[model samples]
Target: MFFAGTVKTMLPKVPSTSGKMDIIRPLAYVREKDIINFMKHNEIQAMSCGCPIEAGKVDSKRKEIKILLQELETKNPNIKQSIFNAMKNINLDYVLGYTSGNKSKG
Candidate 1:
């Protein structure tokens, strides 16, 4: 289901009782239309498990990192390549596993 509203309006007033449901909450605020466009562009039918949430978080982080990299590129054009190379060394599975593990503990 697609939800559109302010954070206060969209979020549940109380905690959710549904355990391990599939829901992707954006790290950065996004308009409903933008989200719809993104889904259309990516050809997504529906979300299952927590993969989409993790993927959304990763995508948002990448975008944020890209902006920072662009700013740093102004100082040293070579920085972008170095950063991208370093990013390749990241164990994404480990990272996601760690995050999910922590969530379960909470």
Candidate 2:
């Protein structure tokens, strides 16, 4: 699951409900295809950033995420299972932009 959109402000400091999730903020106006390749190379499954953060934090975030993954590996042997559970435990009801086809009639 990849999330790319406009976030009005810096991300809130939310506690990690599961394994460490990488948030990549591309630092420039790059082609989406190129960004996808970067994501693939880095194994990023989720993101929480847009143009504002992307303006000057691409390299830093990339390195930070790498370090985070490495630290997780050294600290927890069940990192894979933690990430899987994080992805699986998403509560759609709390998702800001989520919509369901099953809208109730007014």
- Considering only N, C-alpha and C atoms within 3 Å, which residue pairs clash in candidate 2? none
Worst 10 residues of 2 by lDDT: 2-11
TM for every model, in the order presented, reads 0.25, 0.30
Q: Give the alpha carbon lDDT tens digit for every residue of 1-106 in model 2.
A: 3234522322334335464864544543354557789989999875666755455455566456556767997889777568656655766566666434576322
- Candidate 2 residue runs with Cα over 4 Å from true position: 1-58, 93-106
Model 2's alpha-carbon lDDT is 0.57
Per-candidate alpha-carbon RMSD to the true structure? 14.3, 14.4
Give per-residue CA lDDT, model 1, range 11-103, as digits (tens).
323345685464555533464457888889999775655766456655665466557877997999888567445544765555423233246
State, as a TM-score between 0 and 1, how close model 2 is to the true structure. Answer: 0.30
